[model samples]
Target: MCNEVWLTSPNSNTYAQENDDHDAKSRVFCTKEDCEETFGMFLVKETMYLPERSYSELIRSSDTIRNARFKSVNWLITAHKRMNLWAATVFLAVNYLDRFISIARCRDWKSWMFDLLSVACLSIASKFNETNGHSLHDFQVDFVDTCFAPTLIQSMELTVLKTLAWRINSITPFSYIHILAQSVDDLTKRATELLLCVVLDHEFLEFKQCVVAMSAVRCALDQCVIKTSTKNVTFGHLETFIPQDQKDGMIECRRIMAKVIARDREILIRGKKSPATALKVDLYDFRNFSADDDSFLRTPEINVGSGKKRKREEE
Candidate 1:
């Protein structure tokens, strides 16, 4: 399956044109009926292993990560140039790691840890450069009573340092902080994040679909944000343009930010958007060959051992 579905070079116009006829033929006939039947049988065999939910519900549930308000606040700070990209990336990485680990170990989601990690990583990275010179002790004191114990706090600090080292070694020093800051809408922000993720790690093939989907969503958000922000339109004032029925759709746009991230991961791993089937054939022809001539033609073979061979020769 991997060999059959490996990533190929982006399609060229010539290849697309060549496939146009084949695509039309596929649409006109059940070219893959056997493959489809086999897949259906396999699916039936694996029905017990399948998760019980509509794809939409699974997608929506994945979007719950966007409800994470700390991301919004972090965006705000990074937008202002108050935080460096390295700091921002490290902050986010540390926060995500802590959350993932905590969830796995404790089965609890600590939302506040995100805020604390953002602030702490930013402070530490700033101080390391001797530019900001912020007091680390103050940060420790502020979060002391929170979920972080002294030992856990030390571990978090070490984790931040290790992550920073890994990032610095792996990624170029060019900062994406400005691009992210200028993204005035959630879609734009999400798209920027996905793009940055890909840029930071090209091996993250799972993000390709999310990045494409977010690109569309971000463009929509860009239009809305520009209109609203530039025109100074408030929620109350938006009633003039936004209808009540459409309001739900507009709100759902934000949800797409989360959904794209979640759905992209799931799709890349488990789901197949379309069938993995194609018409395959091999052509064969029997032809006469004359040693003295370059051209060949189809002809019945004469068995030299049989009397019919002499008869045909005489004929």
Candidate 2:
């Protein structure tokens, strides 16, 4: 008779012990579990990670709040590219920003405050997701004339952590992309990029993270130049994630994503520059923060990635 045994590390008090035990128990160690029950489990588990406010609710806020969010997100993207941080870092940062704002309800926030909050969010996310240490100086990139003190940034970060109740293990769309895409490397890769772009668009908040992820996978499936094997996973297999009653919502989500992608592609085709690349000629005013203090005025010392610098020199 053969016996099945679960193996655990001798140092079970380590951080990975719980994950190892959970994986052993759930039998979800593989990233590409296509079982219907596994999908159902994921769907249920993802609900807890959703933001308090939906996209519709967020958009219903005053113009000041909406514009602040949009600008802060753009700055985060710029900072992400400038610092060469991980995609997961920026995704988690945005998740924190959304959840914090929904709960904090800071409608009277100024532009510079939003900028500070954005920096704080990215800093918190980088610490959580990256092995490399990032200082507040690294986050000060892309600012025109305003620089936040480390203390201020740290304070805002603490506020976010408290508001989120220290729930830093964010389950973003990236979490489900591989499993829902059936673990195909090509499809997973493309879907991941699409989801990254989708997260930038606030419209995606209308749908659940699972739905957005599934939609990105479908979009990637359509864009696949090579036909993937469907013996194990097919379109019908993905459809099972969405019930007939909820199919319309999925379709709408996909539609929003298509428009988002189309606009993204057009921007690339037109060679439009992102905010980070645009020339900064005008000095940012600090009148909102203080009319007398000049201490906030500091030059931005942004570093260009080696690849980008080399490409630019070649051009």
CA-lDDT, candidates in order: 0.31, 0.63
* Root-mean-square deviation of candidate 1: 27.6
> What tens digits encode model 2's per-residue C-alpha lDDT throughout 1-315?
011111111223433543542353235435435356556665654555566644357556577667777777767766776777776687778888887666556655556766777887888788766767777777775666777766666656665665555555566777666566666777777887787666767788877777787898888888877664533546456457665645767899999999988988643221244444221213555546442342332212111111111111110
Q: Model 1 segments beyond 4 Å from truth?
A: 1-120, 124-130, 137-155, 163-165, 168-255, 258-315
Q: How much is 56 displaced in model 2, in angstroms?
A: 2.8
Root-mean-square deviation of every model: 27.6, 12.9
What lDDT is reached at residue 286 by model 2?
A: 53
234-267: candidate 1 lDDT, tens digit per residue: 2232123333543454345445544545655432
Candidate of highest lDDT: 2
Worst 10 residues of 1 by lDDT: 306-315
As for candidate 1, its clashing pairs are: none
